[model samples]
Target: MRVLSCIVGQHNLWLVLLAAVVCVAGSWVALRLLLRATDRHGVQRSGWLFLAAVAAGSSVWCTHFIAMLAYDATAPVTFEPILTMQSLLIAIAGMGAGFWLALYNRLPPEIGGAIAGLSVAAMHYTGMAAYHVDGVIAWNMNYVVASVVLSVVIISAAVGATIRGTSRNSLLIGLGAFVGGIVSLHFTGMTAVSVTPFVTGAPIADATVFATMAVAVAGVALMVVGTGVASHLIDSEVTHENIAALRHLAMTDSLTDLPNRTGFNEYLHFELQRAEQGGRSLALIGIDLDKFKEINDLRGHEAGDEALKTIGRRLLNLSRGGEFVARIGGDEFAALKRFRNDDDLREFIQRLEEALFKPLTIEDLEITCGASLGIAIYPQDGRDAERLIGNADLAMYRAKADLTRTVCYYEPQMDEKSRERRGLAMDLRSAIEHKELELKYQVQKSVESGEVRGYEVLLRWKHPERGYIPPSEFIPIAEESGSILAIGEWVMREAAREALAWPLPHKIAVNVSPVQLMHVDLARSIHEILLETGLPPRRLEIEITESTIIADKVRSLDALRRIRALGVTVAIDDFGTGYSSLDTLRSFPFDKIKLDSSFMKEIETSQQARAIIRAVLALGKSLDIKVLAEGVETGMQLEILRSEGCHEVQGFLLGAPETFVADVVAVEERRIA
Candidate 1:
């Protein structure tokens, strides 16, 4: 009855309310800091945990001291300075220990909360012990026990709720419970106290000093809590910004700053679904830049990167309205378009071509790039993302294969062709392993003597089901599928071995594909083949087209130089058809030049063809390189070549390509006879 009367009649209501406010504010800040601490690791987590301990200890200490000021003990009371400071240290240490215990995963988080709640009780009792009066102080044991039990239960619930989840509701519940615990503990502990006035001999502190201490404690608590909240807000903003930047980097291409393949794939699926829902048509255009590899080979990768950046900028500038563009590969790009009709699609394709084909200036050198574009319309070419992308790729390859076409719409036939090519490529690999490939020899003869000089080796494939497959049909498949390397090696070995059987030691020429010329160790392979076949290196000749040399001049010339150093001759086959034939001739020490067959077909009727042939032969003579006229089918062609002092000729007039080694040997014997 006495305790109830003291609480109802002897407390300053305004100061009690002020203490409650401080308790709630400090509890909120401490919970926020604790949650942040749990999210971190190592020393950073320890630092946050220390801040949380400081906030929590300050809150409980200030709440107790302020509540003490609110209580009217009916006597002059002053806080003992040394004991009060000791109580504050006890609060900080106890809270720190509880938080450190809570961080262990081996124990339940609620266990840590229970420990923390006990620390609050310990702090309150210690703080109450620091209170001094010019009177005797007594505590009701039952009320004291009730205060400790109720405060611990409430604080434990608060910690458990706050640590379990990060939702706003959880935080609010934890904050409210924490405030209730401190308020309950302070007021209930105050109710346990009963003071009896006595005469004092020494001067004691008055209400003024207690009031000043309460105000100072409240101010410091508020300042600490405010600083914690401010730091949390700043760190949250920085973390959000960092997450957004990382997301942008993941989706964007570093070289071009355009959407990458991953981003394009995601957007494509989204747009496809949107188009399906709206009952509208969308076009997926696949773009591949032609001669891009050549640019990378001739110029540096830096120049290649600059070219891509310029192209990306052009595409980005032109991407307006319901259009999206992305860089999907090294030199491949894709675009999405929502179009109403055929005319709209055509206009968009034209604009895209114009933008992409515009000359890109890299390192003060203007380079014009060509592009092959393919369009796959939604619902027509495909209904889903993967099918649309695949159809677009098929159409793009078709556009690339046909020299005259720059743009193509998706056609069902292209898919069939693609499947057939893939099947043929697989079969070609099997053929190489099974040794199903054979070589034929076309005779190279002296233009004036009408005498056979040597045989130029030709590859022939006789598929079991398809009968005789032409070189024009399967050679490209081999090159595109990367099976040319194996086939080229086989051809060199077989040609060198077969040439050894020739009754005469005539030079045997073997054609090397551009794919093999650039990828294989040509000189080393030749030397190994010569040693294996016991064929003289001087009798082996390697024939490569200007296209091979133009692909990567440095590597190609180096490989050719190494072959020549090994006493193996190199010839430039199909000269005058490439971009820079004279440059190719000047760049390498070629032993012979084979005039392209297209010139021979026109040499008799067209004056331009004659002049070109005359000029090439004259150039070869001046360079002291033997000139070989290919496709010499008629006497007129032979007579014309002989007049021009052509060193060699190979065509029907001399002999047709023979598959049998006996046939070539018999021809050589007949010529001698």
Candidate 2:
């Protein structure tokens, strides 16, 4: 076996192409195996299978080139030694270059295989031609012709595999096979050249020469067609997987991993269809976790998530045949059972309540959570999924309102409250945009100075039909509906602009909800408003509750730091109402602290409340943070706060949150003067 000396003792490069043909066969089989082995879970293992296919393919390529040169040994009688020496050296270098290029071409699988195959055929032809062609460097025209034909075959195969199939495995196999066939075709041609050197003087009729060339061309065409068919099958599999994922997303809550509102709707529809077909009634039970915020404040969101996951699992396990349970919204879940009467469903809900109340162990500590459930029997309490779900949800809220796990049926009165919340959410959006929500300054004066220095921008929503609605009723509603972000931003911008407009020029404080603070661009919005209003950062104050800051401390701190960096003042509102640790206030740069009103209200009757206030004042003074007392309604409370060295005071005693009516501060100043 001798065609050229490249590796050692006249290596045959055709042998390398021969091994590639064998690898093509092996890759074909692996493609089929990979397609069948890949169940839904098996899709994750696709990367390893692909590697194995590529390795087998390159090996075949390596071996074929090595064998080709080895077979070209028959030369002229006298110059056999010199010819053999030259060919063997070229063959060895060609093999090394082929392997190196294979690595470069293996990137990103699909197109890599097609390009690598054609490149190898081109490289082998060039490497072989370097032996004895011209003084000015001649090229192999036949190799160029072969490469063009082979490239066309490989490209056609890839297009076919991509379009024809649903499965990914088929396309990969089709790609590997198509490109591989083109490269191996060169080896078949080499085999033909040696076997029929000079049988028919016409140079085309020789069996060995003509047969190998014909077979090589035909092999390219056949493999291209074969691979093209397999590619489209892979596409089908991909489409099927996508549809399943979309359906799951439509039903499931991404955060809680429970079925959401839409999911509950679809599930109820399906259950009703089954129930109607079977002539049975369906029991729709809605459950809402009670006091979820307490857990969030006491244990943190990590514990809250664990509680939800634990509750979800417990509810899923409790559901029986023809029963479906889904988490419909925040702190809300629904379950439907194909049972007649509300009594049995009520009993099941009772058991669910007890199951939910039982202690759960997460991270080695025992924790407790409870649920309030409401039940409505299908066909008895309205007929459709929407009506049943709405009735159940209304009952659950009423159950929660009383702080009881007792199952209640939906009453006509509950719809009024639901409609009220919907109307408020809609009005809140309009109120914010149309400037219907106004800032009423409740003057915060320095008790010692007796001078009006700052004002808390209290939001007053004046409705045409409902009169003035207090923020206490609508704020929580806005926060729940996610309209708080827009409202909060509007409040901050308006407060800043109005404070800058005030002739007295006192600092203004605006409140931010946990939802607003958690928004990543909270600071950007604040900075833009300051820039737009021409208000100096020093004159504006952003008030956040302790609970809001610690909601997601890391992210919250990031927002706080950005706001603080703008030189704007930050004060914790309702500080003592929550579990505000002294260390948290010390860690953050706080310009002021507004003592919770409940603590101030209790100061008159209770000595312990006064002592707590004293300790807080001392802590504030030690940290150099100015202390302000909120809800100072009585003169006695104002005097106590004055003696305590409280920096500022705000409440009904000073002035209630009244509409400024062009210039209320000026009118109030004249009355005080």
Candidate 3:
């Protein structure tokens, strides 16, 4: 009614209302079209821009509409109110634009479009103000100059933002944008509406409107760029964090947090190259954790993985960062070190030996395991990676043979020995299938009575092609290949059968590998073998190395107690060869202890060996346990053992392990005879 009345009554209110609505609707439509164009072109679309426009306009619209609901109040019309409200409206709109523009501050580079749009909008608002407030002091020559200045400022900001601004660099460009905006706003104000007062020619207000406008522009520019810088910095940091994650994955094991095989290989190759080029001595040591499979099988794989990682961390911590160490395979690790001299290398090796011997606690249980280390030195032992690793691995096997924290440098003769050993291992597995594997009995004599006692049944492998392959030679091979489980099962069965055949009051001893000990159902297996072979469980003794019990001690002890409960004898075989001493021996319940052959072979030549043997025998006497010495080849060893009150002796002098069941019969026949 007012619009109709305006044209007829010569009133301007109708025209103003129509124009205001058109401008508002037109602005909204323009933004929508712009967003659509960006989407169609596949250019980067600004959803934030759309959100911003909606927020500012919607706020203004609601305020206007709510105000209109008051009696007789409709939307304001005519220059009087439109001009009054224009500055405040633009100021609020500029704030909305700035808020959204600042959202990208954490990005590495500020986008050019945001800077350009904000710069232009600042000038545009000033222009709109001038248009609304006519005859303001700015309506002078400054109008043209302000427009040029504003255009240039916006162009500069566009260029700077387009080039991209990193978190660090955005600040400089943002500063430039601020200065430019201020200059443009000031000039635009100077040329806009006059400050002339109600009196036609009175100069506008106390301070020139242009000057005040310039200050406001300066403050607004400052706010916009400040937010941009903050956003850019955030993105930079996020990108850096992503890179760090990738590097961690590449260099470390996911499970163990130690260096992985890739890392190990890199270090090995690097050290090998450096050692070769520098002519400095470098040693590569390969360590294989003994009977690791048993631990996994018994405790479950999770516990096993924990054990491996724990061991790896211990080795890594023990090593100086200068020495490269990594887990190269499951239950196997490789280390490379460059040393000053042979002694220096040996010292390092000794340190590693000590480090490995420390008790490893996993899942709140103290577990023991012995590692065999093979050393391959640069120049002397190998010239390259393949040869060095191969030789070191073979040497480790030889060291494993000794069942000590044994470290061996590769030797040419070791190659032949290793090949022969591997060949024997392969044949030994076949031997079990071919029925060439047999158990023999050796007489156990009482030192006091000089009378026969219980016999020890030892498994003997006589390869058809390689006659009488020694237990020392083939035993480790089988153990390493995991064929030992089968060999072990066979050994238990055969030994039990042989013992059942013996007539006199005698028990039979059968050595079990650490692998067999780890059998989760070992107790059940033992019971089955005893039942099948007609041997009383009480009469069978199972001999195991100190290394077997030493590795993962708590678990081993638990297994030992369970085996003992089944009435099977538990003896620590190769008693003194492992890292454990008599102090740790207290933890075990040993019915008998077998003196290792190293002490046996040197009994006559070595006074220390004799002393060790005598001390062990004395220890057995004190503990009320039986002591026996195997591989007592000479009368000197026998006489020494007899003198020391050793309970039994098994060796060539007494009798070697034989394949013939008749030999056991003959021995028992002799005792019965």
Put down candidate 2 lDDT per residue, 165-201, tens digits, no spaces.
5876756757564545544455433422322233222
Best-to-worst order by lDDT is: 1, 2, 3
Candidates in descending TM-score order? 1, 3, 2
Candidate 3: stretches off by over 4 Å: 1-130, 133-223, 234-430, 464-468, 502-505, 578-581, 600-614, 667-673
- Scored by lDDT, the top model is 1
Candidate 1 vs 3: which has more lDDT: 1
| lDDT at residue 322 of model 1 (Cα atoms) | 88
lDDT (10s digit) by residue, model 1, range 1-673: 6556665788877777778888888888898899998889999899889889999888888888888888887777767788788778777787787777777778766677767777778877877777777798888998899888878788778888888866779999988888888777777878888889777665545667767777888999899888888888987898799988998888889888889999999899998989989998999999999967656765778889888988999999998888999999899999999988888888889899999788877776777888999989999899989899999999998899899999999999998898888988999998967767989999998877866778899999888788778999999999999999999999989888888888899989999999987777878988898999999989989999988887788899999999999999889999988767888888887999999888989988999999999999899989999999998899999888888788999998888899888888898788678
Against the hidden reference, what TM-scores do the models get? 0.88, 0.56, 0.57
Give the per-residue lDDT digits (tens) of candidate 3, residues 130-208: 3422232334445655554564455345334423444655534544553344334433433342343233453333223
Candidate maximizing TM-score: 1
**lDDT for residue 308 in candidate 2, whole number 0-100:** 83
**Candidate 1 overall lDDT versus native:** 0.86
Cα error, candidate 1, residue 596 (Å)? 2.7
Native-to-model Cα distance after best TM-score fit, residue 234 in candidate 3, in Å: 6.5
